[model samples]
Target chain A: MDEAAVSSLAARLADAGITRLGRSLAVRHVDAGSCGGCEISLAGAVALRAGLTRYGITLVDDPREADVLLITGVVTTTMADAVTRTLGAMAPPRFVVAVGDCAVDGGVFKGAPTVLGGAERIVPVDLLIAGCPPSPGRIIAGLVALLEANAAPVAAARRSSRIEPHA
Target chain B: MNPALDVAIASAAPPGTAVMLDAATWRSLAAGDARLGFVGLFVSGGRVHALFTDGSAPLLLATELIANAYPSIATGFPQAAWFERLAFDQTGATAEGATDRRPAIAQGAAGTDAAWPRFIETAGEGFYQIGAGPVAGRIASPVHRRFSMGRFSMGRFSMGCFSTDDTRILRLEHRLGYAHRGIAGLMRGKSPRVAARFAARIAGDATVAHAVAFARAAEAASGAVAPPRAVALRAIMVAVERMTADLAALAAAVAAAGDARFATLLGQAREQSAVALGEAFGHRLMMDIVVPGGLALDLRGDAVASLLAALDRASLVVRAFAWGRVRRDLGPAAGIAQARARSIRALAASVRADLAVVPEGIIAAALPAGTGTALGAAESARGMVYHWIDLLDGQIRDCVAIDPSARLLPALEAGVVGLDPQAAAVLIACYGLSVGAIDG
Candidate 1:
């Protein structure tokens, strides 16, 4: 996507009322074993221009406080345990987003003895953003899709509960 | 050739010429010059080859192993310690009499005990140790650090002597290899064109640099020159990659210094560059666009105009954040950031110049089936990256891609000594260490 489309998307994300739903999304990233391409795009996603932060999405340093776990790269043998532990640390209702072809299915690194394929080999991935390294716009779109899919159910439950109480 | 064996070859010599020397001569030459920079050491075809450069020329010294042991250069050359350890781990060729015999890359394999590598113990009173990640908190590659610190107490409490805020780092040692994907092993037996993919992914940020280096190495080995247009395109990509890297470095530095506004502006500029590259090339980070013989594909229509416009936009942002002004305001803390900004400005100009002179011709030259070995070097944003490849019947027999991070990581470990934790972290960012590149 071009700069103008990304800006409009950022505006829509801000108006999405993600914060009004009562909790800001907290994302924690784990680089299982990446060439770091995904990390760059991920950083761009949170940077001022992409402005995911303006929509109440914050990148947390600690996994325990995170609501979503964003994983990148092929899960290397050495880092598999750490990735598992990171996911296990998050609370219930946590979402795992695999943000690269590597994390989806090891991308170019597949068949390497050191790699154990994608994040699915070790943990359940809720969403997959496929690219050698997905662009920031794509990453933002993925997050938006995830939040929208999740928020609808919560919104419906709240509306029905209020109507039944009144009736 | 016999007479030339006694002396170092000139830089202008053919790429893969190695001077075969006996063990004694090899050791003496390694011990002779403090000016000789140790490039890399690798085992190919049951023989150990050590590459060293005297600024202008590369001198590759090969020695036959006796009982899988060769003379240890780590003793005379401290920088060779990691290389020797890695060489031992990958191949069982021991650097005999080396002081540090620890496994470098083989520590954290699949079936092996996933234990942390042993760190050096500093025995003394009031000294404490703190360990940081195989997984960093930030969006960074995995590498562990052991910091030995000494605490100073301001005053003694009634219970005991309490340490104050005067904690000084005594020593910092890093344990890498978490990102090791067996790149060299993966590249083995594949044609250079196929192996170029592995090379490009060696380090994501340096994708263009590594791809160019690998291509040059393949071209040199196969004795085929990339068309002038292909060379120009490679140069443009390299410059663009450099600009992005510099911008990232500048952004990190400014962010650390709490200049979030400037950091954001830099980030925006970087985003523009990424977008333009995606439009011009197929990929955002431009991964796998460069092949062995030449570019995998030529620039799309109107690519030059879009790329130039993006570079112009980036240039404006960089100039707006005046390096001199920022340095004067932030003092020495912003020194590295300012330098990076200056580099970005220069690279932008270079890219513009390169685009104007891009010759029209075929983008690729066919690499003939050949048998040869060669060393290729490319100046990455961080520093010089070297790729040495041995080709047998058009197949990559052995390959070693040495990133500049190998040397910088050691320097960072030493430079952070006596620095406080926060300052040390800043210094680490300033060094821009690439764990993926180093481990691979």
Candidate 2:
């Protein structure tokens, strides 16, 4: 429930109209080792505000059937095997959207003695909906951007490269 | 409707606590009301001991001594359908008059009827309807579904495993994800902490339920209870998470209902508080905080104070959004949704009657009005999960996760099948569906 920072980040993303990946699109869900907060928000995007159908993108049940893959939850050790198996099942050019902080940096669980950090540890991500669970509108905006004619997400501004001396 | 049994339940079981009724006698008492709601009977000592939740503690229904009984609640409560199949699948207990009597799911019962039975939304007059994957969302999960529409549509079933039986009459058929991550299968010989994370994903919203359930099951075998502090931590964590999910769903629902402004407000409420959860909890999902014997660590002063403060702020935002804005928008909108639902129900009923699709055995069982429940746990993110749990022998007998979305799926379907296709997403949002949680 302590989400002040997460929410601030999400609001910034929303106001920036930075929701699209390439073009707005429908996303299929994948639960690696999630408590399901990301999946909850994904449903909210389509079922609640932007209404997926309103955006002309709808959810299908097969990875092969989807244009985008929204991965939520933590990638658990037990699920490590299944995660690869599922990724293999998706069609080529599959887009992956990491929907929660767990999927991003493994969030609070980064250094747990028995935890796997972030979804990137397992699958390639296209966009990230960062929060313990991101807000639905923010989620919808992200999806909408993906479908827009100019739907590709804006690349992050490059940071100055710095070298640290290793003594 | 056995008077003795009824009297016993009234006398023994209090309101709101769960109790295991005499397993044997439940057969006869349930002869007619195959569509039972509150009580669940686990059979062992030739007596059917009912487990009823009595707001406070478990109430044991009077013992029911019997030999043979009818099992048809499968037709009434949607979730019971899965339970009956699971029970028949796992324990070999038949929910007599059930469909697919063969083993529902097998431990090693592969290539047998015990394998997951999958079906798609087909058999209706249609347009070349082609739907996508099971993991539908702003992001998707690796779930599959089986859809059988007219001729062109193809779907597969993807999900997890459960020991279903006629133990309870609360079945909800999940129409998507036939091949979900098989974490249960992978945990065959793995260590406990490793398996805990896998269990958490069994049902996303029910993370605590599954995690706690697995932990509880482990405790049963280990003969060790968590420290008082660990127990409280688990309780608090689950409650918070449950509340978080519920608010998220509500915010989504508000946005879906055309109150975009309120939806935005909820966004701030949800997104703002979620970060705090990330700060204290190692993983937002809090995967391995709990293990068989006890917790990984304790919540001391600073951690506790910070958590409480975060909770207060998030609560303030949520309360303001709920009372200050959404309540106003929902009144009229709810009316429209209700009317739409009534007509949809009427239509589905007529079609069901015409097709003679009445499930054999039990009849006329449907999820009740005000069946709405928002169960909250502090540690869970999507907030309080509203679900129906049928536990047998302290095991997950069968569960119908009625979380916020289940109620919305039917309404969304109704809204879509009859009205503006443009509002489909709205209906979906209003329904609180994340695709992963939708069950028929």
Candidate 3:
């Protein structure tokens, strides 16, 4: 709803890109507390425009095998632990991409008692795609821009200085 | 209505509202009426309202509660178990003799696992427990399931995990409601037009069904009938949405059956249908397509043409695949029984049948002003969806949406027991349960 705030988040996310890493990236998708709307877009974006596999993005079943975690929905009180555990399970050089308006800032359900706001409240987010449910093309563009941001140095530093997973 | 219920309903009901029956009569009808199917159970105004459909006619029955406690009728209608707990969570009401009393949707304090309830451990030897998801892989909705298993078979299955070490098979507890957005609560005091948006978002995949249901409820409450053209267009939209959802459900089933080739074909069909929906409607999910007394957007001829063409392509794929030939072959391992597969096949066939029947044009009537209470039901992909609305002074007083998933999810949990995790996931997908829909 706040266009200025969303644009700033997008601008911030554009600062991180995987320039030095290999082309292929293993991704683990976690639904923290989605209504399943964002998932339709995620699947559609990957299938129609991006051809995720063609872009060297492979979805894996295990979090341990993933380089990037694409999290959808707002982090509910019930699902906050799963989000924390999932982010923690990912190895170094890992990144978190928050998809949909809910994950960005809790969307229309912002003040709901059950929700813990957005993905940022639970974990550090690298990118935020803002839409009630973002269109497939917009999702692909956001992801591509994220790849081009190239925050490799920061990722490397964060890996060496890692303490607790949530921090 | 049954003879006894007709008398009670006629005597106790006020004007257009639901009938208020005494506790004795309510329990008797709930247990004795063999043809009565439970529609929904909710708490409103210090009373537990039970909705049911007797054959083609829908009936709403209510029983007053004292001190927030009423006698449990779950023994008569097994489905009332969850509704009772939901009633408790929302209004501090309880079914006096109900079996399960855990909190259904009440969120605990932040940072604590207080929201999750523990499973009752059974008595047996060498039984181990496995917990899967409030968050898991691939599934879009979060569901937590705790399974007690032996070396070779599943011992007991529950939804939320707690520390328990019992050896026998206990009840399987399922933890849902993580996606509750307070749609019903949010709709209160809003105009029908404003409330329709919230209803449409109840379950994104079933947006059309929910929108239509809500519109129907609003129209009924206001004593306004939508134009025939609007109704036809609404029917067309519902059919298209159902076709797309069925294809996706089939894709999940086929993939579970290890037929990657067939799954890809179905997936492509679903994708094309979605694209066509976006072309025709403003939104891919077709959100907010229906309004209080009519349809929102008038359909363009080209939009209808593209949607029909897409449906035809999907029908051709379904025929070429010979869906009925493989219907009998599906089993629990594939997450669908032969019966369910047969029904899904029939759904695909219905989509084919719908291709020839298209709405002539898109037209809608203006909303009328009135105040009353009424119920509406629409056939969703899963099953029937019912919506009841009470309007006073042109504003919503109370509303309840009865999603088909609410009735089927418990059965799904019970049926998937003693199976491997992969099989369980497949079964869960086949049910096409929407957590958001149920919570609403």
Docking band of candidate 1: medium
Model 1 lDDT tens row, B87-182: 888888998778887778676454575644578797777788988887665675688889998864334653265455567787898877778888
DockQ of 1: 0.58
Q: In candidate 3, residue A147 scores what lDDT?
A: 51
Residues A1-167 of candidate 2: C-alpha lDDT, one tens digit per residue: 22454455445545656543433454566766565566655655554434566777776666666677766666655345555666677776566777777778876456543346678887776567777667566666666654542332333321234344692
Which of the numbered candidates is closest to the native, going by highest DockQ?
Answer: 1
Q: Please, what is the TM-score per model?
A: 0.90, 0.52, 0.85
Error of 1 at B51 (Å): 2.1
Evaluate residue A87 in candidate 2 and report its C-alpha lDDT on the 0 to 100 scale. Answer: 67
Worst 10 residues of 2 chain B by lDDT: B367-376
Runs of candidate 2 with Cα error greater than 4 angstroms are: A1-167, B1-24, B32-36, B39-56, B59-70, B75-78, B88-94, B99-137, B141-174, B183-194, B220-222, B303-306, B322-440
Cα lDDT of all candidates, in order? 0.79, 0.47, 0.72
For candidate 1, write residues A25-59 as lDDT tens digits: 78888888899889889878877454677666778
Chain A TM-score, candidate 1?
0.79
Reported per model, the fraction of native interface contacts reproduced equals 0.64, 0.25, 0.39
> Which runs of model 1 end up more than 4 angstroms from their true locations?
A1-23, A157-167, B1-6, B10-12, B30-32, B108-116, B123-125, B151-163, B322-335
Worst 10 residues of 3 chain A by lDDT: A13-22
- For candidate 2, state the interface root-mean-square deviation in angstroms to 1 decimal: 7.5
